[model samples]
Target: MPEAAPAPGAPPHPVAGQEPGGPRVLLPHLRGFAGRLIAVMVLSLVTVVGALAQPLVIRMVVDALADSEPIKGLVAALVALVLGVAAVNAVRDFWLQRVAEGAVRAVRTRLTAHLLRLPVAEYDLRRSGDLLSRVSADTTLLRNVLTTGVFDLVTGAVTVLGAAVVMALLDPLLLAAAGLGLGLGMLCSLIAARWIRPLSERAQARLGEMTSEVERAVSAARTIRAAGAEERESRAIADRARLAYEAGVRVARVRAAVSPLSMLGTQGAFLLVLGVGGARVASGAIGVGDLIAFVLYVFYLVSPLTQAVNAYVQVQTGLGAASRIGEILAIPAEDLHGRGPAPDRAVRTPANGAAAEGADGAPAAVEFDAVSFDYGAGPVLDEVSFTAPHGGVTAIVGPSGAGKSTLLALVERFYDPRSGTIRADGVDVTELSRSQLRSKLAYVEQEAPVLAGTIRDNLLLATPDATREELLAVLDTVNLRGLAERTSKGLDAEVGDAGVRLSGGERQRLALARALLTDAPILLLDEPTSQLDANNEAALRDAIAAVSRQRTLLVVAHRLSTVADADQILVLDSGRVVGQGRHHDLARENAAYHELAARQLLVT
Candidate 1:
């Protein structure tokens, strides 16, 4: 049974410190790309040095023209300086691009590895599209920060500092004017920073939301079309997109305001330098060549100021992306320890206070004791207890939402019991390693998710080492041999997404065959015969009986006919067991069981 719900207004389970919450958190991940980043920084410095040398060359050229002393030397020097700066700029851009790509690759690899390790429960609440967006879009933002943002920050600072120094050298009055304009620009940028950060965060979140909506629509395209809700879904998606657009516009507005204010400060500085330097030249306080160089220096200062502003903006976006990525990485990964081999004494035994164990000394029994669970609505199961013994068929019969599927999940340890312990064999399931537990059980879900691959690949997923002969034998057991033979490629035939290429019954049989190939000690099946016709259901029932002889089977049987011949039947109502015995005995002794049997007959 499912667990009890938390109290009203209680806070939800927090998954803090798992995701990249902002750019700050990405510093650790950036370590792998540090060497590349350093190279990029060095290249940017070279570019800045070249840019600074330009004005000095111009000043020399002007002085040479006035002095008429070896004018050829000044001309050659100016041409060489121009060519050097251009060459350095080109090389630096290439290096920056390389660094960005490398950083992006590293981020994607780490993020993917982290996400794959997260517990199944985290994935249950997350949308595939949102996760995909984090891996794809968020990483792209971080790449921009590495390449464009970092380069701009380095070069911009160098340019600004060089220009200020040159302006001061040329004339103190011109330097003061430029400094005042730079101060104002800095103030405006600081103010804009606060606004841009939050807006960027909002924009990234909205992008995830938009992606989720689109994914939802596409996954349920058939249902939407059947219900004539395409327009409604379209509107919902549009609404999310509009929210994203609004968030982007807010960030854009801040950027728009910041850029112009910085540019205005640069223009003001330029005008002041022109006025002050022109006066100094006219008074003979500075040479005309020096005044010309001072104006050019002001232009250099603007380059760094603009680069600084843009770098800050990229940092803002990167922080937003980091926050989203952090959310995913923060979720606790499925613990790998304590799930290894159980103790020797922990074999399947009731006296050990553990669940049922396998008959052949294999750890294949499943038991739930006083277990309860909920999913925020209410208690789905309360104090429910049962044991499905090994080498036999134990059928769980219940109405819809009676915690049947939840019980199966507990056996697989998909979700731990909230207040009670579940055990496989004599060991507490929590003590069993996840891989060890999973290795022993073959679970065939109701929908039977099939990857987009060849039929042989899907079957081999259960037991990769299974030979062609073994595969064909299992296929025959599920009565899918005819279907397999009919396909042009036999077992190699392509199964579309979720095995949509096959009919419902065929898909179920294929899933059964896959499970059979695993030859695991225990089989946890959810509605194995739900999609089968009369003939296929009978064939599947026979297959289940054959499989149960050597392996333990716990089946969630919706149709009473499916469990009528079971060795033991546990009838569940709400989250409690209403009856337990053979099907006929339960029908005679329990009114609910009798009613359920009648309802099954009526439906059939």
Candidate 2:
């Protein structure tokens, strides 16, 4: 049979708990704090020792009082032991909490780095809110695992064992009866915990889905309101919230079963110890002081035993979250260096090389040789070839879905062609690192999405070291100088999340200004004039003409007027380059170009 496909929304790589040896996902985070953990263990041992000594001290006081001896010194010793144990526990708990916080910090840092470095394809397959949930909610679960789960398991076990040993030595028969009650309770708790982990995993997954719904609603709030979809959006979010609640209730039900069983066992053990010890003491088989000490020892086991059972359940829950976190970390990041065998001619071509030549003997800025791409369903770009020459304007004009923006994407190396090669400065792009290729070109996306930050912050994204004069000049070039003039803060003015505070036209202009700030030899703009008015479009055209004098500009435009004076125009139709030449020639001779021009009344 053919191999099965992975579920939707699953990572490309397998996550922890999906395979053998997956539990080690949390090991790296804990490994660095081994020394601190040892210190906690040592302090816990001290607390156990102090606790064991208390029951014996109480027995001595009881014997002295029965013999009519002074008991003040025994009482004082008991009080001092209690105080010392409390102090040691305080120190141990604080240290553990600090270590837990550090571990969580390390996990968050690593997760953030990994998520940011993931390939664009990965982001396309996953939701942003789900990924954020992993970084926030999933990592928080680990703190309880470290502080309460692992620590309690160790310290609680030691305390329970010490008490059991002391009780057995005092009277073997009573000890046997006490063991039955405690063991049954722990067994019931262990069984209940078996069901909690899986339920917790489902709960976490449901919560992530709910988060995705909220993110979608908020980010598209304007559209939702415009379409009169507020009620529909609210219903969608409510459905996700209800599913998450159901999952949480399932986990809570299993957890609830454990507490009562644990309490019953501990209480049963106490009653058994009382009845049997009373008989032994009256018959003179055991002394009154010894019976009292044995009873005290059983009481000592209560707290730790309860802690141990609860910790076991918590450990299971943490494991569930860990599995989700490990999935993202397991996927290999986009290779910074080129993948596959290195190119035979990895070095740059000389200016005289034919491959480097373009119009007027100048080197080409970007070249596509029979390049093609697909989005897994069908090809987006066929065997297409084009050249964006140095110091020239190469405008890509086509109907919607004709792969105009894709051509620019190929130049920036965002997605590699399934066949053929793309070259920048005569070196194949696959031969150079992504950072190296991207450094040579600046890109403004089609939507021109702006981040939530000040105007200065968004502008500095392209060129952090750009001076104040350079910023002002670029803003003026794109006709966005009015934005700074209107606000008293100038560049310090805030652009709300996704640039909500600015008009669509202003956001487009700001994006262009930011791209212009870069000193890259090539600029890629996808529909930069899509949102601009007639006046703004004319101003932007002038700015593009000025920039093209020194750097190559590859613009994807639907407005025929924008590219009317281009040095070269490539008309794409159904992923194929149907026409290429000066705009006037294509408008008169090319069928696809002529039809598009006629529709816009530009063929006259």
Candidate 3:
């Protein structure tokens, strides 16, 4: 049985050193796009130059018109300046979009690689949907931070400052009058923007929860329908959606406030500039042409201010997403380089108080000494010990929740034992690099999950370079050859999602065949024949017997017939090894083994 998940409302397992800084988490990812940013900056400069020159040309045209002189040259210059700025703006937008997309791709690649390498324990605590959200939705949020957030903030600031300088040179009095309304409008927008960060954080977190709920419902759609609980599940999912909607509404409320406040300030400043400049014109302090040019510069300043405000808000939302993404990235992966037990450390005997040795008294292929484990709730395995010696089948039989599967999990090092030591061939399991250790054993899970792909794809998962002959050989070994033969594409036939197109028995055999293709000396099978019929079960037993001739096999079997001919059988009850011996010997001599055999009607 699988370990139970944490109870509802339990605190999430904390990842050490994973605190995320706002927006800054993306800085390292942006390093590769420095060239693109430089190009954007150059374009922005050209835009600023064009903007400054356009108003000057307009002023020249106005003055020439008042003088009644031919103004064709000035009009042409103004038109040229307008077209040039528009062309530069278009190019600037293209480069910024590329930079945004490239940055998002790099981030997603890094996130995917890191999530795959995370320890199995991490998956237990985190939902697949939540992790996927960080990769897809969260990384998408980061895209806007690059395009509209950071770059816009930078370019807008430069443009705003440039316009301000020109406005001050044009007329200090008019500049001062414009600053008043703009400052008030900016103050209102900044206050509104402050609420965006916290609201965005809440919104993204709620979305993650909603995504996890959706994934759970979809994956278990069959189960829900069989239980006639479709409406119940739908209602549960709707509840999650409603919470997400409420959170999003809150974020939208704040974002909506920002836009209107920014607009109000900009329009107020524009009006103030027009009023003041007109008064200056009337006083003869400035000509009508000067008033018109100053009014245009005021608009230029206002445009950047508006963009800067909007960008600030987007940056806040991106940072909110960064916090979620960082949480996953901050987790410490399984220590693949751990240095285990010193050479001088004494190796303890198996908990059975007898050495697990072969004919020559050499150490077993795999041995456990007083190992115990708990899954945060309570003990799943308690001081259990066993051995799978070289070149034979060692079967583990037990009632449900007897920690039958936990033993294989330990050997695989998916989770470390809470106490005691496990060794493979006299070397501490922890001492070997995870890659080196896993390469030594091939494991078939109980559910025998088959990924969505072709038969050829699934077969080549572990041994990617296995030739066609080798693939055919393993399929024949596990009696899965007929599956490929029935398909029109042979080995390339699609298995559909999780091998849904195949029968339960075929999925299990395919999983076994995949494991069998590996040259690993130890094969760990978890209820490999659980879904097989009587005939398929017997054939699988024969396959196991044949493979045992060359490699040690640890089979976790529920059916007594599956392991009736095993060299040794370990009977577990309540996480303790209650019996051990050949199946017939244990059935006759061990009380716990006898009860289990009688229950299965294997003994009279």
Candidate 4:
């Protein structure tokens, strides 16, 4: 497997005690900020108390006016109550915003760190863009819902309860008439939430697809344009966007039910209150001011009722996004038994000329023991065993599908073999944590990728502690000193995205320099010279030859000339090694090796 950025939407493992996509998975993130949550709740209580007081102040004013006694004092109290409501609500909103932002930041940070720790096999099953969307856009929904949905859900309930108590105090018959009808509509809206939930989740997923399409298209823009496939790619992305749009439309259609239901309940309450309260007034059962307050209380239900309905819808939307994020969290991480670093006894400090100890204390760098593996589709490595000699160059050459790269992946521990053990020194790679095992090797991938940063940043990616002189030495080794001289900021010069500013050969050499700078004893190079021209190739071969004298080098090469003089050559075909020996010896003894060398005129 190739090194990849974090991926999205692989079939995730289930969260504990929850069906795979259930909203219960959201509890951990919500629980993380208990303090901020408490603060928000306290502020909400203040807001609700202040809001509930306004209705009673109106009642006091209306009763005072009816009695023709001290209207001015009651009016002043009403003004004070209204200002208090505004003040408390403003404070509540501020706290809710802070809590929402903090929660999402922590979640995003944890998700990103977890992604880096995942086994490489996970990357094979997920699309990078989709994973990025989950981290970015999908997580944003969680924050919004946390603020709008969770907050509203809490405050709305308090407002409803306080309003209910006041309404009962104003007039029981009027309250009964309004309450029953309003409760029925709100209950029905919540029932519709079940239908709306999946649609909201699907909309987020489809949007992830759009993000995936866009990322692929952008990354391969030059290839698409060169091949004149822009229209085809654009159409594909547009189609995904269309599906996302349709999914969003369905969510909207479901959510639209909330407003009309709230409106229906509001209208229903107004009619019931007007008719019942007017009857009470005409019957001289209650004062006109009392009837007005009863109607006012009935209208008060509309504001919080609408907020509650809207908040519930937002919660459903949030759960939809949470389901996607949960899948990522649910997937088992690729930790080595969740253990810490290798014991101090097993630690191999890298000196200038280090060689890992094999079983029986034999001098070997890496050993693959009876390794057999497949990538779900079919077998890629079959009963393969090889030992990379310490302080020497061993080259693996094979046809396109012969599992040469797969062998390198196993050594890197990207995926473990099904029926074998890979050892760094005498210890099984599985016995060490991922960080521990990777510490022993420096791997350069076939397509030599550079990250978005300055030239110096890319150089020091693996071995951050290397001195400036050491950095200059590796750059010079790869014949990239001229690059340092040419750039305006020298090592500090920006490389642009993936080092696009550098030529193909420069990228490959820079990647090689990064690997060389590492203290790792084993160097694994996968077609590192694939992009180089004759001049750079010769320089790299010399560099490789010089490096191997001090460190173990295992290289996978397709082009025969690059590895023609390797100390040992392993020739593979159809997932099995058919030959292994010095280059000239293999050419004479093995038919497959002979044919490969003959094609390259290496044995003609």
Leading candidate by TM-score: 3
lDDT of each: 0.78, 0.85, 0.86, 0.80
Task: Encode model 4's per-residue lDDT on 206-257: one tens digit a residue.
Answer: 9999999999999988899999999999999999999999999999988888
Residue-level lDDT of model 1, residues 1-604, one tens digit each, is 2333232222234443244366565577668768866776776677677778888888888888888767787778778877887887787778777767876787788789988877666666677888989999988898777665755776677778777776777777878888888779877876887687678878888898999999999888888999999899999999999999999999898888888788778778888778877788789989998888887887777777777888878877776777777776666676665563222212233456535545565554777767776665777778787777777899998888788888888788766655666777756776778888888899988786777888899999868999999988988898888877886899888888778788889888888888989968999888999999999899889999988899889999888788788889988889888889998788877888888888878321
Which consecutive 10 residues in model 4 have the weakest lDDT in total?
340-349
Stretches of candidate 4 above 4 Å error?
1-26, 30-32, 336-361
Query: Cα deviation in Å at residue 32, candidate 1?
Result: 3.1
TM-score of each: 0.90, 0.93, 0.95, 0.93
Residue 545 C-alpha lDDT in model 1: 91
Candidate 1: residue 131 lDDT (0-100): 90
Which of 1 and 4 is the better model by TM-score? 4
lDDT of 3: 0.86
List where candidate 2 sits over 4 angstroms from the true fold.
1-11, 19-23, 338-356, 360-363
